[model samples]
Structures are given as structure tokens and as C-alpha cells.
Target: MGQDYKEIAIKLFKQGKFDLAKISFNIAFNETPSDELLAFIELCDMAKDSPSDALTLFEIYFDPANDDSAQSINEIIDIMQSSVQQSTMEIESQNAITYADFKNLLNQNDFRTLFESILFSTRIIITHKDELFELVNFLVDHGFLDIGLKYLEGSAKMFMGDERMELMLEKIRGKDENSLK
Candidate 1:
């Protein structure tokens, strides 16, 4: 990595310029994902200055459908949960933001963009029966069927217990495709 890139990454991180820092770091890390750089990034994450950014980064690092990384998903999940617990943003700060409000929000186009971002990141951790069940059930209850389908597809890989797939296949067997459309 060039000295200028490192300087830019650090400056952006310090300025709370996370997305920019992430872009810079990706370029820099591409050249050298050395322990020093990785540790520095982790330090910035644990600094708790940007809870949502940290959580989102951790989510991308441990995707459920992709087990190609050297880092353990559990460790990443631990970090994400920590960030979530420490997040300062209100989950219901918008006007009339109830559970129903969030449900509707999840279905919105903008929210789907955010949802897809998280899905890409947390796919790995979300595949566990307990986690996947909780996540999918939450989205389903909130009327986010698109999110539910995404989680269900990922969780199916880990859900190898009974003939549940068979049962599910049966349930959808007689459904009217035209009506669904």
C-alpha cells in the first residue's frame, strides 16, 4: 500500500468518514492485509465511535453462504452483537415508528437496500438454526417476505434435520402461481 493511501484511510477513519475509509482501506488492504493493518482496523471498530458501521463491517466479513475467510464467524458475530448493544441510534425515532412501522419500513425500497446489505454480511451467522429462525421469523412477522425468503434460502443449508424441505415443498405444491404474481 502507498503511504498516501494509508494516510487517507487513517484520516478518514479519524474523521468518522467510515464509507470513505472503507473504500480506502479496501484498496490499501488489497495490497497488504497485513496483521498491522487488520489490527488497526479492528481497533478502529472497537473504538465504538461508529456502532452501525462497525456492525455492518463485521456482517460483511462473516457471510454465512461463503466460508472462505480465515476468521471465524462466531468471533465476527460477537463483535457485531457488541456493536448492536452499544448502538446509540434509536430503532424507533421516526414518527409513528412502531413494530408495525418497522415492518412497513422493511418492505420499503430503501429499506430493502439496507436489508440486502446486512443480509450479505450476516449470511454466515444467520444460517444457524437459532439465529436464522429468529431472524426470518422476525422479518416474517414484520411482513418482509423478501427478507424472509433470503434468510430461508441461507438457513436451508444448515437446517438438515427432518424432511422439512419435503414438507415445505408440499405446502407450496398447490399454490396458484398466477395469484402469487
Candidate 2:
């Protein structure tokens, strides 16, 4: 049964159906836990969350004995950076939002950075929980409930067992439910 799921996951992964692949990989891991399968699951999760970081994930998971991959990964990073620059240029031309306003907003609140970071990255190393909870409440109060919910859902595992995180998760979940009505 585990092998069956693993096969399905591999196929899904090759097809770029990362979310489905992750689901299948999780099922496979639960049935017959292996480090390789777990790594694949992690890759699938990362791929689903940040498709642009796929090469980074590949570098992390691959064997260190192979050295040729570094140059290729560097090239991929360069290409990605170029693409991001082009997108930023396009956005700058079209959007009315000014750099000063964005800078001021970020400077005005530390949690806003946390919200933006968690929105993009699957994992973020955060040392401050007080600021995180404060940001969650601020976002929720300011009608950024969807962004707050996404950040909480993504970061909940890392901050698990903290009463504040749990409470905010519950609050965001309730808000999400109500908003759907």
C-alpha cells in the first residue's frame, strides 16, 4: 500500500502536481516511514509553497558527493533574480503604491514584515513570539484576515504549544469561517 502511494506521489511530482504529491507522500510516510520518503514529502511541500525555490530544495536534499549541481543552481538563481526584477519593474510601473509609503508601513510595524515573509516562504526563523501575535491581531483588526489566516496556518507548526499562537489560530479560523458566510 505504501509502495502504491509512493508510486502515485512520484508520478504526481513529475507532473508538477505538488500539492497532490505531498498528500500522497504523507500517506506513504504514515504507512511506512522512510527518510527518503519524508524528504520527498518535504520537497513536495516546499515546491507547493514556493515554486521559485525548487532548485534550493534540490540542492538541500541531494547528496554532497555531487559537486556539479552548484553551478547549475547558481545559474537558476540568476535567472530567477532576473525574472523577479522584470516583474518588480512591471509592478512599479502599474501600481500607485509608493516606495516611501511601503517603507513607512514596514517601519511602522515589525509584524507586517513577519506577515509578508510568512506569506512567501514556507519556513521563517522567528525568535520573537510577542511581536508575531501582535501582528496577527493587528492584521485581523485591520481587515487583513485572509493574510493573517495564511500566515498563522503556515507558521503554526513552528510555534506550536504557545498559547498565543494557538489562540490566534483559533481566532483566525473563526474569522475565516465567518467571512465565508
Candidate 3:
């Protein structure tokens, strides 16, 4: 987007028109991902006290090979660890789930980022097979797609497209686990 829109977005954020600022950012993002704009969005979300979403933004900004990705991941670690909601290893429903914020790990340096991500957040027990399936599938598609699928197709495999699985997929789809893609 042009500087005009970005200017407007800044104005909106400054004026506390957070939702509008988000819309403006959306316009910029749809046109092209801007690391700078991503930073602004992070600031905006932080201004709004929604660091959870900020966590998503870093996933897009970071590319492992870049010299800054690891630093960014460390920043993420500080942010997530600081959040009161996620400080402890427990969140009630899966909704409270802190996604595996691993884009920085995807950066080649943090080979075990995913594992660390999973370990850091809450992982609900697999009770009702339906919710269990959805969680598993989410882990597959976002956290560990190949492994998740393998688990699905393997001995512990449950049929995909089960009504339960589909709902979870829908919810997960709406969540931009990774800000970039």
C-alpha cells in the first residue's frame, strides 16, 4: 500500500482506533508483507494488549537464514514467557492454547524450536475423540503437518473428515498460526 494508507493507519493507531488500524494493516498485508508494517502491527497488537496475535506476526517476519531471525525468536520467547496467561503450562480449553510460535525455529538455526514451542505451551489431554482428533489434526497441519498426518494414518490413525475433525480444521483455519502463510 502507499504511504497514504500507512500514514492513515498510524493516525488511527495513535487515535486509539485500533480496529481501523488493523483494517489498514490488512490492506498493506494483502498487497505485500512488509517487515516494517509487521513491526507496526506488533506494536498495535501490543497497544491493544493482544500479544497473542503479535506472536503470530513474528512467524511471518522471521526467515531462519536472516541474521535477525534468532534474535526475533528470542524476543518471542521473552514475550510469550512474560504473558500472564501463558506463563504457566496450563490453559483450560484448547482456545487458550498458545500456538507453537516457531517461525524463528523454522529459520535453520533453531532445529528444535518446534519441540520447544510444543513443550512451552499447554497441550490438552485427548479425551473426547472428536476434540482429540481436531487437536491432533491442528498439530499436524500447523505444528507438525507431516508427523500429524502420519499419526492420523498410522495405528493411532483416526479417519479424517469426521465431523469432529472438520470442525477443528475450520477453527484452526481461521487462526493464522503463522502470520505469513
Question: Per-candidate RMSD vs. true structure?
Answer: 16.9, 12.7, 15.9
Quantify all predictions' global Cα lDDT against the true fold. 0.53, 0.66, 0.54
Ranking by TM-score: 2, 3, 1
What's model 3's TM-score? 0.31
- Expressed as tens digits, the lDDT of each residue in 93-179 for candidate 3 is 353343333333345544345455565463533323444464456464555554454434552334444565555555454544554
As a whole number from 0 to 100, the lDDT of residue 118 in candidate 3 is 61
Q: Compute the lDDT for candidate 3.
A: 0.54
- Name the 10 consecutive residues with the lowest summed lDDT in model 3: 95-104
Model 2: residue 137 alpha-carbon error in angstroms: 10
Stretches of model 3 off by over 4 angstroms after superposition: 50-181
lDDT of 2 by residue, 1-181 (tens): 9999998987887677888988999999999997667667766655644554653655543548766655544554455557557756765665333333433556766755644654444333322455557666878966688777776787777567778887887787788788889
Model 2 lDDT-worst window of ten: 119-128
The model with the greater TM-score, 1 or 3, is: 3
Angstrom error at residue 3, model 2? 1.6
Report clash pairs, candidate 2. Answer: none
Task: For model 1, state the Cα shift of residue 145 in Å.
Answer: 17
